[model samples]
Target: MFRVTRLAVPVLALIMAADPAVAQDPPLCAASSDTARTAAEVIAAVAEHQCPPGSRLRAAMTVAGQAVVLQRSGICAPESVRTMTIRPTPDTRALDTRALGFTCILATR
Candidate 1:
């Protein structure tokens, strides 16, 4: 029984170490405000910094707690999707990005 238990422990350790999911690193991320003046620019900067060549944009959104304004004439209008403007709220003003309020995720193709 003692010898079996000793062998089982090593076998279990080897099985767990062979898992691809356990060996993989978490996704990379980057944020920049100094060079990224617009949403497009911010996404580009983050991709350049964190993603490898041939990567594509996966998701983009404003940072939490940042105030923003969405303007549109009417819901049914063809041009109703107007613009999204980021404004500095008291809580977000002190953030490292100064409330530019842009973040992006990228994935390898």
Candidate 2:
């Protein structure tokens, strides 16, 4: 059997609270150097978010070694959802809000 660690929830919750746009659900995690693989992995990670009750990938964008994804809810609301970054090590996988490192909540104009 497989289970999400008790740890992942809190990390994702912290990411969610970092942005009002992400408040409707917890963030998802996806990582890889390849964009296609990142999208595939991200689609798989959606369940981790417990999102929408019904949702699907509407679009994905890769920028600066990360994937910025959008999801369409069952209620038809579009969300700027999970942000996944490619890291060379698990030690670097932790999300932060700073301008200096790998962050799920990257600042965008």
Candidate 3:
């Protein structure tokens, strides 16, 4: 018979968390913008940056007051999908790559 103790639960959790597969970083996203005003402009900012040709902006949403846009390129290998945030300025909006800094996200596929 096996008995599970309270301490064992946390230890097991820590061990599981340390697993490479689970702990690995997610896919990264990047984009940049010069000047933007409307949401459409913000979304387009990514395409202007480093997005592959024929890639399109799939979705745009505001989370916790932050605007995020997702870009996916069907033509690109690995079918990479990326997302970037559009920050509001006093005048127009801008996508700041420095803010994200190779930030990773779960595969959008």
Comparing 2 and 3 on lDDT, the stronger one: 3
RMSD of each: 10.6, 15.0, 10.3
Q: For residues 35-61, what per-residue lDDT tens digits would candidate 1 score against the true structure?
A: 325444444565467655222222223
Residues 10-101 of candidate 2 have per-residue lDDT tens digits of 99889888987865633323321232333344445544543443333332334424332223222223343444434334443464212212
lDDT score for residue 70 of model 3: 31
- Candidate 3 structure quality by residue, lDDT tens digits, 1-109: 9999999999999999989877754323344332323345544554455554433333334341233223232222234444455455555334432222112222323
Best by lDDT: 3
| TM-score of every candidate relative to the true structure | 0.33, 0.22, 0.27
Clashing pairs in 3: none
**Candidate 3 ranges beyond 4 A from true positions:** 24-109
Candidate 2 local lDDT, residue 35: 29
